[model samples]
Each structure stands twice: as C-alpha cells, then as structure tokens.
Target: MKTSHNFKLTAAAVMLASALLTGCNQANSSTAATKADAVVAIPVEAVLTRQGQISSSYRTTATLEARAEAEVISKATGIVQKILVEEGDKVTVGQLLAVLDNERQQYSLNKEKAELSRLSSELKRMEEMYQRQLISADVFEKLKWQFDSLQASVSLAELALKETEIRAPIDGVVARRYAKVGQLVNQHATQSLFHLVSNQQLEAVVHLPEQQLAQARVGQQAMLQFAGMTPVNAELVRISPVVDASSGTVRAVLKVANAQQQLKPGMFAQVQLQFDVKTDALLLPKRALMSTDNTQTVFVIDSEHKVSRKQVHLGYQADNTVEILSGLELGEQVVIAGQSALKDEALVNVVTVRQF
Candidate 1:
C-alpha cells in the first residue's frame, strides 16, 4: 500500500508539471499573434511651405556669330607669289595679305614710264619751237596730246600693278586660308583667299514664339551661358519685324561685348530672358503636382490622418517649383514623393517631412 501511494503521488506531480509547461507555451503563442496583427509603418514624405522667388523667364538656345564677317577674295587674276598672313593672324584694314607675281606687270609699267618720259620731253621741245614759229601749231598740239595720252596710260598701268597685291579690307582675325603659293587666281573670283571675322562684338540669334513677342522688346536684359564659360550679360538688340508664317516665331538678336574675344562664331549658347515677377505667392515642388487632361491636383494630408486630393490652379513655375494660385493654403502638408501610391481618404502615417 505504501509503494502504491508513492507511485500515485509521483505521477500526479509529473502531470501538473506538463500542464503548466503547455499553458506557458499557449500564452507565448497568443502574444506572438497579437504582435503580428499590429500595423507596420509605411515610408512617406511631406511638403512644407517656404518663401520662394518666381522670376518669369524664357529659355532658348542660340548660336554665336561675329558682328562682321567677310570672305577675302582676289581682286585681279595672277599667280600667287607669296602669302603675307596665315590663319589666325590679326590684320588691319589695307594690310597686305598676299602678293601675286608682278614681274610682267612691273616690266609693262617700266616700259610705259620710259615712253611717257620721252614723249614729255619731245612735247616740251615742240611747244618751245611752236612759240618761236620754228614748227606748225598743229604739229606742236599733236605732240602735246600724245604726251598727255601716254601719261594717262602710265597711270593705268601703275594701278594694275598695285592690284597684284591682295590687301585686307577690314580689321579682323584670319579665320581661314584658301589660296596657296603658286596658285592662279582670277579677278573677282568667288574662291576666298582668307575668311576674316571681327572679334570685337558677338551676337546670338534666338527665336521666340509670336505669343511672347509683346513681352520681348529691345533693351531687355538677358543672361547667356556657353560651354567652358560662366554666365555673361547680354541685351536684346533687335526683334525681327516679320514672323515666320509656318513656325509662328520671330527672331531676336542679342548683342554682347566680347572684350576678351573668348566667344567665337558658331558656338551654341543658352539664353534666359526674364519677363515678369511675382511676390507673396504659395509655392510647391513641381513633382508634387499631378495632371490629367485639364485637371491638375495635389495630394494633401488633412488633420484627420487621411490623404485628401485637392485640385489646384497653378501660376508661374520657376526653379523647379510651381506657384499655387488657389485651392491650397500655406502650412498644409502635401505629399511630394509618394503621391502616386495614395488615394482619397486613405489612411496614412506621416513618416517624414521635407521642404519642397
């Protein structure tokens, strides 16, 4: 009877221990389930209002061109004897650029000079003889006329000799050289011996839409940017009186002083022309707005912990931000980064706040 009681007591203790362990495991599983049902935090960003400047500006691309350009061509036909200036050399007006072989021309001029001198001496002798009645007046007059004709011929020959030398007509840099030594050129030839461009001033021509023509006028300030250089000041010099019928655009020429001669012809540049300005306007990041057809909307978080889609009228956009004309007030939180994943009245947890 004592062994049976001992065995029964041991069995009861073991059963109680197993029951306690099972109840503890059930409690742990229940706690785990409760933790799993809790909502997870979603990553989001908010928009904040800040003072921003909106300058009404137009952007366009233009090509740089020299104020004056000319193609230097040969004025007379002859074989090129020498080239005085090479490419990239600075030349002034009337500076000798090239010389043609003038041996034949020089010989002709020398012969003319000799004949003119001889005729002049003969005419003087004839005039003295006629005054003294030694020869007829008609004979003396004929000699005098012959002398004058010879003198005129000599002058013409001298000018033709000078034409053998090519000279620059403008003060500029030689951009190109087309004729080489010993090459034959024709008078008034279309082939350019040198291309010269004036570097003192530069201009850029940009096209503007006809609707904006009224806003763009002469004397408007502009900013220009080119490759390998910083922004430079420019001004609206002229606007084309005629507009392109097909494109509906007008050309505007911007003049800029090139004191350093750094800007060259045919270089592309970016131009910014400001037309208007606004103050005390609500601004938001351009990315925060959504558009469909003619309806523009932005997602705003209200005080009820839900996202509300509001339609907004936009004003001027400057520096990647758009002006909020209406339908939204200052200090209202707007979703900038995650608006595509949101809907009207959707539950949201503000994870981050950022300035837009």
Candidate 2:
C-alpha cells in the first residue's frame, strides 16, 4: 500500500510540473507580442516630385531712376514773366515751358532790321556807280562790307530774341519748378528752372560681382521688387565691359517698365537676374536638401512607409527651389520635414503630404 501511494504522489508532482512549464512558455510568448506591437513609427512630412520651372539667379539691390532726364535752364538773363508748366505737369519735347520778358530783345531786333535795310539801299547804289566807273573801287568795297556786317547783326538780334522762351528739352513730367513768377534768373547751369523726368520707362543701375561678369548679357530677364509693392519685370539693356578696380564689380543697367508712372527715381529696389532657366524640370523645395559629408542628400519615403537616404545631383537653384538632376524620379515622395531624425529603412508615419 505504501509503494502504490508513493507512485501516485510522483505522478501528481510530474503533472503539476508540466502545467507550470506550459504556463511560463505562454506568458513569455504574450510579452514578446506586446513588445513587437510597441515599435515606434516616426512622424514626417513629405512632398511628391513634380515638373516645374527653375532658374539660376543672382541677387542684388539698386536704386530706381528715370531712363531719361533733363534739367531745363534759362538761356537768357531776364525775369520769369509767364510760367506754362508746374511741378507734376507733363510736357513734350520743345514745348514752351516758360517765357521771359521780351521788350528789350524785340526792340533791339527791330532796330537791327531797319539798319540792315538802310545798308542794303546804299550798297545797291554803290554797286551801280562802281559798274559805270563813277565810284572808286575802294569806296564800293567799303559799302559792301557795311551791308554784310548789318546782315550779320540782324541774325544775331533774331537769335537773341528767340532765347527769351524756355522750352522742354525732353518728353517728361516736370519733377520740380525752381523759378517762381517775377523771379530774376541767370543763364547758368546752377539756375535750373524745371527738372524733367520721363517715367514712362525707368532704369536701375546694379553692380554685379566680377564673378558674374561672364553671365551678364543684354536682354537677360530680371525681377525688381520695391518696398510694399508688387514685383516688376526688368531687362538687362546695357553692361559695362570694364570692371571697377576699387570694388571688383561690373556695372549693369536694367530697364524697368513704368507705364503708369508709379515708380520714381531714387527709389530702392531688390533685383534678381536670371541667367539660365529650365522649364519642365524636376523641382524640389530648397529645404528638402540634406548635406552629408560634403555631398547633398535627401530622405525618400517608399510605399512601405519606410525612409531611405538618397544622394542627389543638383542643376539650378532659384526662388527657394532647387533642380533635382538625378537620383530621384517623378511621383516619388521625399521627406521635407522631420528628416533630421530619419535613418535608412526606418519606419515612418506620414504626418503631412505637401506639394512640391
């Protein structure tokens, strides 16, 4: 009886041992599954590749100016009698801008004319006498000389009378009026009566670095932006071949359109010159670039929700966009944000899909 009881106790102990081992195995398997489900997916923002326009650009700042300007000065010393145009008034070339006192000039011209007429009658009589041998040759020559001198005097008098009128030298608007009515003015450079500026077209002279001298060319397109205004289009019309020794810069002139006369001279502007353009090229935001070991790289997201590092070749960069020459294709997703924490083959949770 004792042997049989011992055998039963051993059988029960073996069954309990088997149950404990099976329970431990089940608990370990459950813990492993829970840990696997907890693997983190990093959040990131990405953009799909697309075709767009890009250009290689150089940037600079300059001051706006009138393409054509002139300072109208008095040609005769006289009092300002009649003013025709005021500041902000438009005038055409050769249009009368102001008139000076003409009483003295007119009187002088009339007197000279009368003298010329008198000399002409005397010279005719002297010629007749000389032809008939009734007057000496020397006397006839003296009369002819007097007639020529009187004619020259009349011409001078006429020119002086015409100088009393001030005219517009260029087609432009009066920027300023210096001489007031009844103000005495002199015929000198310092005494400018009116300042004229043509705002139908404007210009900005920008100095480019000597390194960009090779890219500067006439007819190249550029953009100009003013303070609190819409950006305007401009073109490179002239470029100075010689470089400045002091500044290491090249002089370039840009023509800007101002048909409405909204832009003025001496206004500051920001300039961006596009030397090369690539239309229908693959473009990406400049922020998407990643610099790694002296080379440029990017983080790409595959359809499996994993990120992979890629090396890209660049073409042109402008306006915060860069051209992707190689290592990417159309319709691929590139991580633009949260890429700093990304690694190859790492699982990702796309937080946002943005446009390129």
Candidate 3:
C-alpha cells in the first residue's frame, strides 16, 4: 500500500512539471513572433529622378590633316641663290620664297630684247618700202614673219627669267625646307624644295562602321579632342556613299575651324559624333541601375522608406547619365549606391542623396 501511494504522488508531480514546461514554450513563441516583426533597415545612397539634357553619340578615332597644303618646287633649273623663308614662316600665294641664279637667264632676256628692238625698226622700214612699191608682197610678208618670231622669243626669255624665282603657290606655313643656298635644283628632276600647310582649317577622315551610315548626315555637329588637348567643335562635311567591302566601313569627313592654329596635321584625335540630342529628358545616373539576367531594374524608395524593384526602359546614354524612357516618374527617389543588397519591400536608411 505505501509503494502505490508514492507512485501516485510522483505521477501528480510529473504532470505539474509538464504543464509548467508547456506554458514556458507558449511565452517564448510569442516573444519570437515579436522579434520576427522587426526589420532592419539597409543603408543606401539615393537620388531623385530629374529632367536634364542628354545626347547620343558615337566615338571614333581619326588623324587630323590640314585642309590646304602644297609642296613648293623650283620650276627652273638653277643654283639656289638665297632662301627667303625658313620652316615655320607664314607665306601667301604668289609670295617670293627663294631666289635662284638668274645671271644666265637675265643675259638671254637682254639679248632677246635687243634683237626684238632691231627687228621692230626693220619691220617698220619694210612696211614703208612695200607702201612705196619698192618691195614685193611676198618679201614684205617674210620680213613681217621674222619680226613676229623674234617677238615670241623675247616673251619666252622673259618667262624663263621669272621662273628662276621660286614663289609660294598657296597661303600656308612652311612645314619643311629641302633647299639650301648654293644647292642645284633641276626642274625636270623631281626635287622637293619646301612643304607648306594651311592650318586655318583642319580635316579629319574617320571610317564609320556600315551600321552608322544611316545616322550620319552633313552639317551635323561633333566634338574632337586630341591626346592632351581639350575638345574642339567640328562639323560633318562629307560622307561617301560607297561602303568599303574589305573593312565594311563608310568614309566620313569632319572639318574643324582652327582659327587659333593650335591643332596639327598628324595628331590623333578622339571624335564624338552627335547623332541625336534631347534637351529636356528624364535622366538618372547610370549607377542607379541594377543589371540582372540582361534585364535592367532600379530600386525605388517609397514614402515609407520601403524599396520596390521597378523595371526601367533606357534610351540615349551620355557620360554617367542615362535617359529614363519608362517605368519611372519625375521626382521619384531611387537608390543609386548600396542598392546591390536591397530587395523588394526592404526598408532602407538613405545615407546620401545627389543630383546628376
């Protein structure tokens, strides 16, 4: 009877302990539910979508060239007497550049002039004789022809004398000089004297991909920058209709006014061909975008600081800025930096806001 009484007491005590453990579990479950309701805010950098200017352009490289250039050569064969201009001297068309040995040419011109003077007097006397019937028509005609021939010889001699002087054929700056004093140059021989280039206007020929031909047009504005220089204004002046089969490119010509003459002929330049432009465009910094699986998205923050993933359509992209085509509104807050860790409905603690 004593054993049975102890067993019954133990059973009652076990039941009380089990009931206490179950109540504790219920209280812990309520506390866990409360903890689950609290959400941590993610820190992010955001920006406001705003209206701005944007442009679409194609980039290419081209070597600059002078629009006007010439190779100065000697037209007469003679020893170079004096060099009037050195490399880098400015010259105009018809400007005397160099003198040649003209003693021989001068002597020939004087001899021809003396003979022509004598012939002129003789022709006058013969005409007077013919009028008096002292000379026949055939004889007078022969004498007149001789005078005309001598006149032609005098003109030739005068031209030969002028050819001894070298002149600039174009307005430009002398780029190179090949002739020196006492150097014998032959007109028949291909001897280069000086090279001149005009930098008032410059040209750059760029090869555009066949795909860009449709976007190219005359009078289009562009910008060009050399390796170590600031960008300058340029204009599209020409486009070749034929496409090169080997390279699959179309030839394009860009002209730039170099009134300051700061650019050179062979300098490599980066060209930005502006095909389209928008003055009032809805834009966002390119950093505000998330690219996943080839789909572009942005995390937009609502009034409650909760972020939602929005699908965005993009248009022309300029430096660091992209045009928003759809799926966004003006003045909407978007997470730019620190958005990689965000998801839909995630609470955000905005750290910084900036404008593009």
Candidate 4:
C-alpha cells in the first residue's frame, strides 16, 4: 500500500510540470510574433534641418513705361513744306523737326521792314524841327509814336516768320509722326504730331493693394521678370499718397536703369518686392511640412530610426524653403519624402539624406 501511494504522487507532479512548460512556450511564441510585426521599417527620404537666410516677399504684375513721355504738337499753322525726321528718330530738345510754308511770312516781314525805315527817317526830321522850335511838343511826340508803332510791327512780323519751323520740345525718340511733306497742319486743331519717349531709364508701374501700403516704401530693392528675358534689378522710386478710388490701391513706381537699352517701354513684367530678410534662421524644405486638418506637422527622425510628428511654428516663407520658429533644432533630420505611411514612433529606413 505505501509503494502504490508514492507512485500516484509522482505521476501527479509530472503532469503539472508538463502543463506549465507548454504555457511558457506559447507565451514566448506570441512575444516573438509581435516583435517581428513591429520591426518593419518605413522607407523614407529625409533632410537635415539647417540654419540659413530667408526672405519675405510679395509679387505683383506691372507694366513698364519710359522715364519721360510726351505728346509733341506743332505751334505754327501752314502747309508742311519739309519733314526733317521720321518715326523712331532720336532728337534733342529744340531740334528742328519740320518746316511750314514761310514765303508769305517772309514777304510780310520785308514790307514791314521797309515801312519801319521810312518812319525812322521821318522821325529824325521831326526831331530836328522840334529842336529848332519850329514844331510843337505834341507834334514831335505824335511823330515819335508813329515810328515806334512801325518798329513794333516789324518785330511782330519777324516772330511770325520764325513760327514756321517746328522743333522738338524734349530730348527723346520720336515714337510717331502724324505729318508729312505737303500735309497741311494747324495749331488750333489740338492734335499731337509726334509721341516722344525718353527710354534711357525705364519705370515699372504697379498698383499695390491697400493692405500692403505699410510695407511698401521708397528705396526698397525689387526684381523684375519678363517673358523670355532674364530678371533685372530695380529700385522703388515713388509711392502714391492717396489711394485710388476706383481700384482701392496705391500706385508704386519702380525705376530700372537701361544703359544698354535692352528694356523698352510697355513691356509687361512681374515684380517681386522684398519686405524682410532673416539670417541664421532655422529652415527646412517646404516639402517636409505636412498639413492635416488645418494643423501643420513635421516628421522628425531620431537616432534609433524612429519618427515622431512634431508640431512647428512657421515664420517667413521664401521659395521652396520655410523658416522654422520653434519645435525643431538645427542638424535634426526631418522626413521630406515618403511620409504618407509614417506614424508616431514608427520605425523608418532612410533611403536618402539631403541638406536643407
């Protein structure tokens, strides 16, 4: 009886041991499976956050104009006798442009000159008579008045003769010519004979929105770009004081030096006005920022190859780069591409590293 009782006890102990060992092996297998599932790394491209310079700017459409423009008109009236210049001719101020018929004016001036000579001889004789007391003071004074009137008439005739020549009023390139040889032109018609433009310096005219008036100031640097041309530098020259009632905007003018005469008037342009610049700013590539539900976040990678979403504050944005005001450090790696599959505390495999 004692041997049989001992055997039963040993058999019960063995069964308990076997059940515990099986449970322990199952737990180990479950742990291994979980680790294997979490070890998969998300492939991503990343960039190192850097310190650099950034600028805030505004862009607007503008039209180029000449430094000075004028509509030229003739002051004399007669048949056009000769045309000295054509369109696109460069002329100086007071340069003769055309001539009118002056034959009648010349004849009138010669007749007036002869009359003045006769009056001067009579005045000399009258003065002699007055000195000898043979004529009264009133008679001498009347003869003097007659001679002065003839002299004035001759001066008027000379002025009329000179008016037959048309001259340029400003130094510029002639843009148009409305009169030709043998064409009749009149002074009172109120028509422009030529369009003159001074193109040594070009100007860009733009209407800035009223909200930007505080930032727009004279002497600021600007950049101008046109289709099929390289960008050029310009300076802000003028700003309108009053807002335009029709557009609710202020007019700003930028001046550009065209020493080589490559820029012409009436070219459409895109102007970039720089408002502010920052040096040594924390910057990141614009693609690194992800916007979700009005919230901006950046995926930052750690030394262990894990990514975490970090909320950031942004400052000035320039081109493809953005200034990071907070929540990021210089030299930290941020995922720039292949971010769609990333999550918090996710393992990542960096395929490429780029410098911002």
Best by TM-score: 2
Which ranges in model 2 have alpha carbons more than 4 Å from their true place?
Answer: 1-40, 130-142
Q: Which 10 consecutive residues of model 1 have the lowest summed lDDT?
A: 35-44
lDDT of all predictions, in order shown? 0.86, 0.91, 0.92, 0.89
| Residue pairs with backbone atoms closer than 3 Å in model 2 (clashes) | none
Q: Model 1: residues >4 Å from true position, as ranges? A: 1-43, 102-162, 221-233, 270-273, 277-281, 302-307, 343-347
Rank by lDDT (best first): 3, 2, 4, 1
Predicted model with the maximum lDDT: 3
Candidate 3, residue 239: how far the Cα is off, in Å: 1.6
Model 1, residue 108: C-alpha shift (Å)? 7.1
How much lDDT does candidate 3 score? 0.92
- Per-residue lDDT of model 3, residues 1-356, tens digit only: 99999999999999999999999999999998776655458889999999988988889999999999998888899999999999999899999999999999999999999999998998899899999999999999998899889999999999999999999999999999999999999999978899999999999998999998888899999999887788999999999989999999999999999999999899899899998889999999999988889889999999999999999999999879999999999999999988888889998888889867
For 245-329, candidate 4 gives per-residue lDDT tens digits of 8999998899998888788899989899887788899999999999988777999999999999999989989889999999999
Candidate 4, pairs of clashing residues = none
> Model 2, 1-356: lDDT tens per residue?
99999999999999999999999999999999877654658888999989998888899999998989998888788899999998999999999999999889999999999999988888888899899999999999988888888899999999888989999999999999997899988777458899999999999999999999887789999999999999999999999989999999999999999988889999999999999888899988889999978799999999899989999999898867889999999989999999898789988889999975
RMSD to the native, candidate 2? 2.9
- Lowest lDDT sum, 10 consecutive residues, model 4, at 34-43
What digit string (tens of lDDT, one per residue) describes model 1 on residues 161-210? Answer: 99898999898899999989999998866678899998878899989999
**Could you report the Cα RMSD, in angstroms, for every candidate shown?**
7.5, 2.9, 4.2, 5.3
Candidate 3 Cα deviation (angstroms), residue 285: 1.3
